[model samples]
Target: MPGLYLIPTPIAEPFVLPEYLKEIRCFVVENLREARRFLKWNFKDLDIDACLFLEINKNALDINEIHVFMKNAMAQNSDVGLLSDAGVPCVADPGAVVVEKAHELGFTVHPLVGPSSLLLALMASGFNGQCFAFHGYLPIPENEQIKKIKSLEEESSKRDMSQLFIETPYRNTKILQQLLATLNPATRLCVACDLGAATQEIISKKVRDWKPEKYNFHKRPAVFLIYAR
Candidate 1:
């Protein structure tokens, strides 16, 4: 029987993909262009030009159509690879629908090992990984954002659980300011940026210790975590 391969793509260097994930060709990707580049760069021996590509993104998610596509592919005993733009799929990406269907249809779902910014940040942040919560993106509005930050901080302090979250790369600085302004001075904040890359930096310091003028993450992929004391 055909299986659904949940392949993890490199978070930074395309050449870093695992050797075991090089065989699969029929792919359901978050972005066709990036997937193509990744395959060509990572697996130079394969003919990426002849590969199959099915896009499953937030803007165009026809669940029924995708369900049919995977079902037909599975019927032929041809494995379908699901690749996320970055990190793992279905964890902040849009492959959950197809993965759930695969399980319901009695098809095997194989999860291959790869790097995840969320996990990498948590592991390196020196926070409470056992009871942590991953909040993908914080609120955008001023008042609501403040309220949410305070609530997350409170929960982190009371439960001794870390709070992990991300921000749109462009809005990263703005969010950092909010964290500095809202979170308690004693709260430890971990700003992990450029994970899995040479320029990666993971700084864990109290809110009062962070200097807004000294740091800039304008368009860098970053993960933020908080552990209240």
Candidate 2:
């Protein structure tokens, strides 16, 4: 295939779908080890050598690196599958740069619609999903990050909008703490965790309702929801 395959994978459980075996010839993912493990378990019948592996993080992959991937993509008429470490290919995760590049190269890019933690969290958030904005990860500096959060809060409150974002898995607790500290107690907050996984959780409460007694957010990826009055 001249273009790329923007393949969508499950949020947490990759082995859930058996059809993943027949989906694409090669997987151009961030991690090949995990991919192999999941595939061997899910589709053990599939030939291992038939799959070509590529490891390129979205943040680290530059245009030149992308060109190499595209060139490899053109080698065979076989399709190239692009997946993230989690969730859908292009939502909050990697694959946007390659997708855009494939389009610029006049390749027919196909997106395999599947599980997206983003949309799942939003729908289950119980927020006003009709008006929502997904501000992926915020800036690194605390000041700029706070500014982005404030802007989202202001917009959500003024227009009754819903602001959605995710944090690094390890720093999830810290982001929750920041949200609790910065967001007004009166503001409505929702925490959606482990979507489509074995130990999934979703909670809707105000910032003021946070309880140190029962809340324990350690080593879990979560979606933060903020809505202005």
Candidate 3:
């Protein structure tokens, strides 16, 4: 069973550790400190120094580093765990490159079940789940963001699909404002914030119904979904 394991870390408080985690001694992660802290927090008896941790650059994943990591793990016949900063690995994360490299090397990849903010938000959005798309992060510039929002709305209307995207925690409010101002009045918007946490909130309403003054998701992790049909 020496292969690559895609492990999920908790997105919020009240972490749940899978039993298989106890067996992983080698890890490929976005942040070394966070990964170590996660393991140590979940397993008090785990010897951090004895484990092998390879950090992947979140912004720009290096294929050379990934190849070396996978090659070494395969050569040693050791199980390697892939960890994201939170939630499942690969989805909306640079860890996808790691998973891709693992496959190219003909290594077994096991994906463990865990919370994913995108799926969770879509499930609660009351939108067309059967036909949906996750666009990851939209353009940051105000004009570009506005244009992207409009295009996504049009695409959703044309296909009767839901459009989902996320933004930097600090830019949550800014994106919300752009979404409200640019989308048609009849378009439905869903904002799921602080998912998996005690402060979790999900609100779905038409563009015209959203009350900007009543909500503040600034600096809070959130997912935004839109459906025009």
- Output the number of the TM-score-best candidate: 3
My TM-score estimates for the predictions, one after another, are 0.93, 0.85, 0.95
| Tens-digit per-residue lDDT, 70-182, candidate 1 | 88777777788898889888887779988998888777899877888999999999999889999889889999999999999999999999999999999998999989999
lDDT ranking of the models? 3, 1, 2
Q: lDDT, candidate 2, residue 146?
A: 81
Candidate 3 lDDT by residue in tens digits, 109-193: 9998888999999999999989999998998877888889999999999999999999999998888888998999999999999
Model 2 local distance difference test score: 0.75
Each model's lDDT: 0.87, 0.75, 0.89
Scored against the true structure, residue 54 in model 3 reaches a CA lDDT of: 87
- List, residue by residue over 40-65, the lDDT tens digit for candidate 2: 66676878677777767645577787
Give the residue spans of candidate 2 off by over 4 A: 1-3, 14-23, 139-145
Lowest summed lDDT over 10 consecutive residues: which window, candidate 1? 13-22
- Candidate 1: TM-score? 0.93
RMSD of each: 1.7, 2.6, 1.4
